[model samples]
Target: MTRDFDDDAPRRLQDAGGLINARRRDEAERIRARQRDDDERIYVVTTNLVIDAQEQLARRRRLDRIWRAGAALSWLSLLAAVIGTGIAWGTTGDLARFVVGYLICGGLFLMSLLTLVGVYFAGRNVSSLQRLEAHLASQQKALWQLKVKSNPDVDERGKLYREEVTTAIEYYQADSRKYRTIHNRHRRPRRLCGRCGQLKRIARNARDGQPDLCDGCYQGPDAICSICSRIRSCASRDEQGQPVCVTCYQRHRTGEPCARCGRTKAVNTRWPIGPVCVTCYTAVLRSPAECPRCGMVQPLIARDDDGAEVCGPCVGFAADYTCKQCGRAGNPHSRGRCAHCVLAERVNALLAGPDGTITPQLEPLAAALADAPSPFPAIQWLKESPNTKLLARLASEGHELSHELLDELPPNRNQRYIRRLLVHTGVLEERNEDLDRIPSWLEHELADKPTAHASLARPFLHWFLLRRARQRAAMRRHPACADRDLRRRVSVALDFLAWTDQRGLALADLAQEHIDDWIAGATSQRRYMIRYFLKWTTSRRLTRELTVPSIPSQEPQDLLDDDDRWRLLQRCLTDDALPPDVRAGGAITLLFGTSTERLCHLTPEHLKFDDEHAHLVLGRHPVLLPPRLAELLRQLAEQPQLRPQLSRAHPGPQWLFPGMVPGKPISTHGMTQKINRTASRSAPRATGRCPPSLLISPARSSPT
Candidate 1:
């Protein structure tokens, strides 16, 4: 939009463009208005509308004066009438009675009537004047909206017009005065947060204008503790107005006095002052003794002269209370007695069970308690390790674990895990002492582990780690251990096998660094060994990120059916539309469906065969397979219909079924896909029989 300006468009011109113009237009307007400045003044323009109001104001003031004047005249007229009546009465009482009464009473009555009429008319005039003022104000606002601002040449006036109209609406329509203070205009009182109970302004500091909850709720992170299901810590920050262990912190802070010694303030508070320390708090909980009078199970206190462990208040008894048992004054009272003092009053019988005494026992169930370990676990080291910080931290976490798990590992503190790996190994050998270890152990040990059969623990340990501990220790001493990440991965693989789920562990602990290393690992020949470890360590989140593309469906492969796997190689190799990776994958999956993630580790050396026997050397030994799987492999070795023929490249990178890569083999993902496709294609006509890779209904009749 290019535009040449209209002649009157002075405001429309945006730039001067260095063009100079000499003009004297201002003088003409001033010259014309100079002669009748007063007549053409702003007041003159609107004078006609309010001229009558100004006149009426004056007339009303004059009328007020006339009212006073007439009132004075009326008083004077009544006084004269009274004076004339008195004079005539004295001369002739009976003869001038009617004239005296009429003149005196009538004059006063007429004066009052005239004054009332004048006041009514004056009120009417005031009402009319206010109505006229309001009408004039409305008209003034309308005129202001239509009026153009200060430039005579400018035709377009959007900016000025809008501003004036907005002003008219706000100024004349609003009841608020122009000079109102901000506090008076919009301030609201502060309110309490319903959730957290912190006080905040009702309208201010709101998120999207929503009302704020109290500090306990709104001020902290709103997350629940993974262990307790109590709102322990929020995912977000406290300063950012999210939940931050508010309930937990508050519960800790609002401490009551020592139940054992009621006089002492018992708990920690928001202020640095007040209450017993944590030691005293713990003591109060453990020392349970009853106050017979109050029938309250309170902390134990020393017995007094009366043989009663009375609470602080009860000790000063001076009132003439009846002795509960004897009904006498001051009989020697023991516990459960009143001030009159009878000893076995039974005011509060002990709440203990029939066979009552403190019995300390370990909480969780263990497989066997009889077997003592070859070495004592680090019992002393743990007790001395941490008093509060780490011990409290671990105990708070460990206490909820099942017996089998807690016993398997020691919760002992002070011993860095790597320092005494053997001790842990020994203790795991005997999981019967879950409680013998300090309580702090439970909180830390019990979290985030898979369930295990108690009966199997003793044997599993003898097989899995203890028997191999020496081997592992020897391996750790070796040099040139290139893949530390992969080694760490091996631990998870073992963990995956040992455990069933990733329930208790924090997702943050299992990071991407670990996953990438695990996928890159190529050391393990036995894929299941590492696979189990991966499953153990893999959190639900990491599981999604990890894409070994296992049998696409969550079904298990049928060990009974080996022919379907052979069919897969036929379909993939014959189908020209199929990708090389897919065909390679299809062929490899037939051997091990779970080895989907470790296909690259496979090598030609794994394929060993003869007319009598054929085996894929997996897990450092020959895994002899059925004739069908063997036949499929024999066909693949000779076949290259869809790919370039190898020029004497001995595929012996140790791959059982090598693909395009010279040293590297096809990956597990390809293997998984091949297995899945084969399973789905063959599964339709099988009636109840299905591939393990497919989901199956758990039959109510008890599926094996």
Candidate 2:
């Protein structure tokens, strides 16, 4: 039974194997059918994708054709406008009709230009579409590759095929998403023009991606400049400010260049040249001329042989004649004589007098005049009898011509003139007139004494005097020094020196006790002056180190209270009956806190006026003058006779407040006396105070 079962098993196994093989065949057929279905589906999807890509390519090509057609049409329109404008210009008989046709053709030409620009932008868009279509074509190629790679025969389980198909599908889906994103990004929304209110697609800013105005409104010629209100196409906002056209902006940037000297400086005035620099304008206003020979800009004093403008220096050197007697070079006078030779003849004629009688006084005077360096002094002496008499008196007294002698004379005009001539002639002794009043005892000590103490004291005295003289000169240059104060300082210095000498102490041996003793009995003014001298000596190492007693500080009294200042200012402004000098002086003093001494020294040259402002040069810096004060100063400057009427001396035109002495500003004492007198008359209420004199006290009392 087992043998029979075994033989039956082989047959059963064969039957079972056949049945299993048949089932496998059915499964293989089912798998092959599914593979065919998947291939068909893939082919269908790839065909649809390829068709879509082709459609996109066709659409891009159509856009390119449209762009090219629009560009051709724009060109044709431009050519047609040009031809029509030329025809209208050539055929029109009436000017009005021609102008109208020209305007129409010009408008057509501008529109055609705008159309060409739009077509160019459309071409760029078409290029972008072509790039997108090319990208889609590449995607279609990749999908075909994916389809070819996905073989159901090689991968019978279809795992790798399904994976590849899924990957390609995802890639195509991603490409579609990318295209949509690009399209949405490139597509701009339409915006209305701010100016014309026309709807148009605005281009986005590349940096911030914000929309900007349409080309028509942005480039319109109707835009106005904020500054000049001129219509222009090239208008833009400048420096975060208002919009300005190119012409107006250039005008603002480059101001008119100076016409004279060709400098790009601020224009002071307009001239035939165009504009002028302030320096050239001032020179022109002064009536200066350019010298043709030397090419120097100067006042026109003479003409050259060619009749061109020549400066004084050039004219002086161009003289044709030399003096016969003095051999000085100068232009020829009448009769071929130079100026010096002519003046020599005049001096000789004056020396002979009308009767040709030469007196004893006249003989020496004539000899001195003949021996003089220049003929000017002799000629000047001949013009004035007083000068001749003064020279005769000096010659008779056997005294050299000196300032001391001149100063000893009465402060008359003739004396002052002679003194100035002596100074100019270099015959006067050069010494400080203030130092002549030094104590005779001190002078004797410095000159006669030869002791160790005197040796040190002499040089110290000399240095002090030299320094004081320099200070006085500087103040006189400002014309602000007070002679009384200078004399007082000298007196104080002499007293201190004498006191120390009496104590048997040299400058090198000076101790604090001597300084303290000096300060013990001295007035505040004397103490102040002595302190200055000691400080100078210590600085120069002429004395041993010593402590100087500090003077007690005291507040200076106000010269003018607020009420007084108001009253004074009102009087200066309104009072016409008051003398102009007094009014002007009072105003300057009250306004600038200047004393009478400074006011007296003020000259017409000190006051400067321009178109916009007025200035008074009181010190180093110029003080601005108020309108009313400026007018008062102008009035004061205009009046040539501003000297006090009490004096008969000719003060000359140089002094604003002429003193009793000619050619000198008013003395500080004289100024004080005058102010006292004017104060009584001008401000009768302030009698005992002497408001004008009080002005000087405060200035003098204040520390320098």
lDDT of 2 by residue, 54-93 (tens): 7767767776676676566667656766676677668984
The stretch of ten residues in a row with the least summed lDDT in candidate 2 is 642-651
Model 2: runs farther than 4 Å from truth? 1-392, 398-421, 424-457, 468-487, 501-510, 536-542, 575-579, 594-598, 606-631, 640-653, 667-673, 680-704
Query: Which one wins on TM-score?
Result: 2
- Model 1, span 493-541: residue lDDT tens: 4454343334334333554555444445534433333443334324323
Residue pairs with backbone atoms closer than 3 Å in model 2 (clashes): 259-275
lDDT of 2: 0.60
For all predictions, the C-alpha RMSD in Å is 34.8, 37.1
